[model samples]
Target: MTYRPTVRGRRLARELRRLRELQRLTLQEVADRLDWSRATVSRLETGQTRPKPNDIADLLDLYGVPSPQRDALITLAREAGQRGWWTAYADVFTGSYVALEDEASLIRTWDTQLIHGLLQTEDYARAVITAGRMLPTTEDIERRIDARKARQALLNRERAPQIHLIFDECVLKRPIGGPGVMRAQLEWLLELAERPQITIQVLPFEAREHAGLDGRFTILSFPDPADPDIAYVEGTMGDVYLESAEAIASHGERFERIMKQAMSPEDSAPLIAEAARSSP
Candidate 1:
């Protein structure tokens, strides 16, 4: 089984790599100094292997990380090795997005083709999975559906992330699972929009020159200021997670621009309700 690391794991890996670079130490140098294999050092630095707290402490001592910061990093290393709920659906998710999404305090998403996963109904999701040909067999599709439903539970969890979705107007009109399914999906969006923690917006077709023309993306922010925000872009090739300050800033500005072109939540909700009624 392939082991997928959690967001904390990735953060720990980045910090370790940064520390090595700061001290101008090569991977081989560190491995030789610590009497460990170069492969072991590489795996830990790349997040391919779970980090041990004791090993992390030893590294910290070598790097001269002091006081509370060192303690915090050790805590993070331990947390990084722990499994998250998404680990159960590893076959379905196959990426770090779910883990990061699970831990994010805020999720800002823009969907051009369909509704966001958090707002998709079961029937709607099934239709989408079928259309995308994401899974080879019915059983696999069903498991993925189950995984998606489980992901939606995050919206109801205590101190759930504040989810903001901006959908292209065409998404509301696309009938993915026949008329009934499409209607249900649109109605579901309306219901979710009523929640205080959720915000829904629609970018109408009239807005020909929109900022999201580049593609769909999600920006996740954590409650802890120490944890930097992430910008994620998904495509036919694969998924990309952008962590650089410049990348995050660019995505943030793009989202803000799209939001400006999108309808207000109040207006979007009514349009969603109308689309549901008119789906047939």
Candidate 2:
């Protein structure tokens, strides 16, 4: 299958292009130094193709990068090549979005509807998937649920990424899969709140004006310094990945604005607890 390159893959490609330009190394020259085909180097730099670990090491050597920098570059390339676990559930998600989610070292998520994927309980996830009329089959739905569950593992990793999530009050009021499922989901969120690495906040309905009112979006920050930040905006049809510094900066400002308007974690926890209590 011809899967589209991920946001992280494209960002890695862009960085390679920038570095090559900085060194004034033509693609042919670099390829010659590495004894590789010019087309191979070009594809990798253009994000038309993914490169293996050995390929990354060879290219870094050809670029004459220092040891420390070379190691980081290689790591970025390796990450770009690894297939995301979501790929197994390719029937459920857009490929590019899955890749971006996997590469993110820090995720700032704001949602106005249901719970975000990383925070969703199994019942909640199943309910959401069932509600999507376009989904194909029961197996497909299970695959997606499994994929989401796997993604949650990132939160439990020894070096887990930092997640800061802000949810609109409407999300708490909307009951998916009836009250039992909703209660479990809210309880799950409450438990997640206790994690030192996670930060959860809720925006009250009375906060009539908020930056996230535009819709849900996520800002993904990478471990690789050379790779630029990405903003992902998903809608009914497709998703958009924002990579330019100006675009990233704009999203960052919006995130800050929403964070300022939303309730603090201390206040938000009680709100969630109250919602769980009210659930029938």
User: Which candidate number maximizes TM-score?
Assistant: 1
**Global Cα lDDT for candidate 1:** 0.90
The local lDDT score (0 to 100) that residue 32 gets in candidate 1 is 93
TM-score computed on alpha carbons, candidate 2: 0.83
Q: What tens-digit string does per-residue lDDT give for candidate 2 at 18-114? A: 8889889899998888888999999998787876778878776666788887887788777777776666666656547666666678999999897
List residue ranges in candidate 1 displaced over 4 A. Answer: 66-68
Model 1 lDDT per residue over 1-280, tens place: 5556677888899899999999999999999999999999899998888789999999999999998999999999999988888888888887789988999999999989988888899999999988886667899889989999899889999899999999899997788999999998888778888889999999999889889998899999988786799999988789999989999999999999999999999888888888888977
lDDT of each model, Cα atoms only? 0.90, 0.84
Best by lDDT: 1
TM-score of each: 0.94, 0.83
User: Where's the lowest-lDDT run of ten residues in candidate 2?
Assistant: 1-10
Whole-structure CA lDDT of model 2: 0.84
- Residue 8, model 1: lDDT of 86
